[model samples]
Target chain A: MSTATATRPATPRAELAAEHGLSPSSARPPLPQYLRQVWARRHFITAFATSRTATLYSGARLGQIWQVLTPLMNAGVYYLIFGILFSSRRNIDNFTAFLVTGVFLFTFTQRSVTSGARAISGNLSLIRALHFPRAALPLAFTIVELQQMLVSLAVLGVIVLLTGEPITWAWLLVVPALILQTIFNTGLSLAIARIGARVPDVSQLLPFLTRTWLYMSGVFFSIPQRVHAGPLQDLMMANPATVYIELVRDALIDRHDAPQHAWILAVSWAVVAFCVGFWYFWGAEEKYGRG
Target chain B: MADIQHTNGQVPTVIVDDLHIVYRVYGATVGKGNAPAAFKRILKRQKSPALREVHAVRGVSFTSHRGESIGLIGRNGSGKSTLLRAIAGLLPPTRGAVFTDGQPTLLGVNAALMSDLTGERNIILGCLAMGLTPAQAKERYDDIVEFSGLGEFIDLPMRTYSSGMQQRLRFAIAAVKSHDVLLIDEALATGDADFRKRSEERIRELRDEAGTVFLVSHSLDVVTKTCTRAIWLDQGSIKMDGDAETVVNAYSSATR
Candidate 1:
């Protein structure tokens, strides 16, 4: 160590630092090492998520009940407009169950992506103060949405039963579908976190983007009847949001049929989104807190 | 540079090599602009008229050895906090680099780690965030709680605590782990005299464990009392670097 430190008068200071076995303070670790670091902080991630979810409505009078009420109200307003006003329930049995399922499922993705935008910017204090993997913040945000999704799931079950939908053995498929949706959301949250940190204006634009996605996902209407056959219908069906919604609708509503290729598309979308999002986010790991 | 050499064959733990950190703040517009103008500017890859560049730490270099506590003394906006942030890996350097043997824990006064959470939770989360396992964090829990002297207030939300209490909790959580390098930015100033003395003793114990501590404080008395060496920075460059007493005296007399 002394030899490397002493015989380098011509060397730049960076090289001298390297000779002393020092790494850049802000350098990103290798991908595998980074993933390991994230895994080790799983306890932190879960604790943070639980705490955030608990405090999300602490200021409101309704408190945690709003967790269930917020989604129920969203479904109510959409039902009044689309179900009663526009008759978006055209040719679909159990339209109440269908619409509720769509709103709840799509909301999981919607909240994940939107909150992902704020994950870094909102938690600048925590990021600057602590030395954990920056990925934990996004992961925690995703889990917060997941906790809410679970609450919404319980409400969805009651709404489905009230709409007279049967609970077949196929209802078990909701587990796999939700699991896949979560993976996809995690990846998307990670990617959006990095983007939102760099371009804060993205947060302003996210609602519009997510709204457009919600419409394209056929959240309120039955795409099979409303959309004409061709590439357009196939494209809509292949949409990850639409795919997850359809899978859940199939499992819950006895009359609703998912596309034969739904499971394949679901798995593919989850894998692709997660891998790309993780890789893209990791690319800028070291640049998170800096201006 | 001071004639006193504290290096007793210990290897250098931190090498801040000619570090330069420039902060670009948006929304400092000189002229009013509408949406279309902003869009056109973005499309053309031209910087926003609101852009303002601040060169905070300009080519500052220093090497810190193990078991040394160095106090960074400077006036407000003189880049003292920015220098510590750069050393903690929270800020990217505009030029040159900061290299460290291990991760540096930065204890800044502004962020209490988690303000909304209870002090008890913040301790656990803060410890876990710094890579301590749940078991290790739990083991350190009582020590941190006692060190903070938060008492029953520990069970209350951190936001309810005064700034001094917040700083105490932050220091206790940070000091629990024996870091390879610890960069504290004005966190100790909020503590009362008793807390300050306790923390100074803790800082000494940390140094005895072969760790390097870089403290940025406006309190010259604290600097002279706690640090073995001191560096006075002015306008982003070291004005004087020497014995803590000598540097503090020079800085005080010169400022006077």
Candidate 2:
């Protein structure tokens, strides 16, 4: 023990350890932990990214075709009941397309957010044994969800084309919108994931919560145009999802100018969600390595 | 993340600096067997603490040079696993520091694997968890498959493997990577007599190569056969750290 205590480390371990008293020890991890994590699973993440994405599409026999088809089918069913049945007293042109895109995107965000709720608890083995960014869990989750998003987008694109919505410059906004949506999803997901690990009840109610949220998201109505008709409508329209869905729809489908408040709402929601989620998740950094 | 390969070729391989570790368990759905069946407890409804705290590892400090094979002998709840976990950096010490030459692998009694995934997929994930690169993992894949002896069943889900089989596969994966320091948490009992002998030979080879190994096991036979040194832990403190047989013999005699 005395012999072990006599020696001191000589090599630079990490910048954080050298410059600051942060990280595990005064020394940096010899091999970058990130490199180790990536090295360990380069093949797996890649294979999973491609294989799961492809297989998840369940494609060849309209197998994964359900990726896109499932949302569209839901949209069509809802459109018949809501647009044609109960709301038949009113009128809105191209209502099915608008509703489907909104419904589809809302579902993507909801699924991405809630699935992250189970991320840490589900991977207890890896977390307890290995040291990597716990962020990796939600990031992988976001990637998988993005795969579903791509399938949904393909479906929505075909519908937009068939509905005679011509391609235009506004389509460029979709890329940024998609990127913002991903960041927003990651933020919200991490936030939910932290609490969900400690509170098992959160996972149980996640499906119900998401279902209830969809109604308030205005996927079945002209939320932007008639957004202030009642307190309920006003409240729904105020939701960040409402702004996101309308912004995407306005740019891609309606080919109209977005409301003045849309960007304000979207950007604030994203920033708050990102900062709040990242810090909240980081605060629980200790739990991840525990069994 | 700390490595201490000596320029003078005499560096210690592992170090613990006043290390402490903590764990908090929450929302455990304890079955209600302890609850009163009738109105006997109605007058005294209990509202106990929700967060159960276990001081698994206390202010522990120790280190080992490159060739040391140290065994930890202790009772079931005697903090042996917790100390191993702290040294492995699996659980960060709450009050101190652990600096090792490199990362270690801690394989406990329960072989932890993603049950839904096949043994082969788990093999890949296991290697990755140990920090092996994809190409390196690929190169080592054949050897790993052969060593586990699970054979064709390697492609089947790990949940299907017997607990013993799972342990063997885990050992195979963790052993593929060389470490400046390696920690085993009572992971013996994976195979029959011959395989244990092979594992002992492998540990000897690793020690001769100047790698440090930390093993925690209740079996005195394992400590006697494999370790150069041993530490006896009880109630989160070291009772002894010295020659393996001498320490185990003392502890065993006292307990008896």
TM-score of chain A of each: 0.95, 0.77
- Predicted model with the maximum TM-score: 1
lDDT of 1 by residue, B205-231 (tens): 998899999999999988998899999
Candidate 1 lDDT, tens digit per residue, A1-291?
A: 112323435335566567768877888888999999999999999988988887898889988999989999999999999999999887888899999999999999999999999999988888888898999999999999999999999999999998887778998999999999999999999999999999999999999999999999999998878899999998998999999999999999998899989999999999999999999999999888874
- For the record, the alpha-carbon RMSD of candidate 2 to the native fold, in angstroms, is 6.5
Per-residue lDDT of B244 in model 2: 92
Per-residue lDDT tens digits for candidate 2, residues B113-165, read 66666787777766765656677778999988887777899988777888878
The DockQ of each candidate is 0.56, 0.23
- Stretches > 4 Å off in candidate 1: A1-12, B1-8, B33-46
Best by DockQ: 1
C-alpha-based local distance difference test score of model 1: 0.89
For candidate 1, chain B by itself scores a TM value of 0.92
DockQ, candidate 2, vs. native dimer: 0.23
lDDT: worst 10-residue window of model 1 chain A: A1-10
Which stretches of candidate 2 lie above 4 Å from their native place?
A1-73, A161-173, A205-212, A229-238, A254-257, A261-272, B1-10, B17-51, B92-99
Please give, as one word, the docking class of candidate 2: acceptable
- Give residue A93's error in model 1 in angstroms: 0.7
Instruction: Kindly report which residue pairs in candidate 1 clash with one another.
Output: none
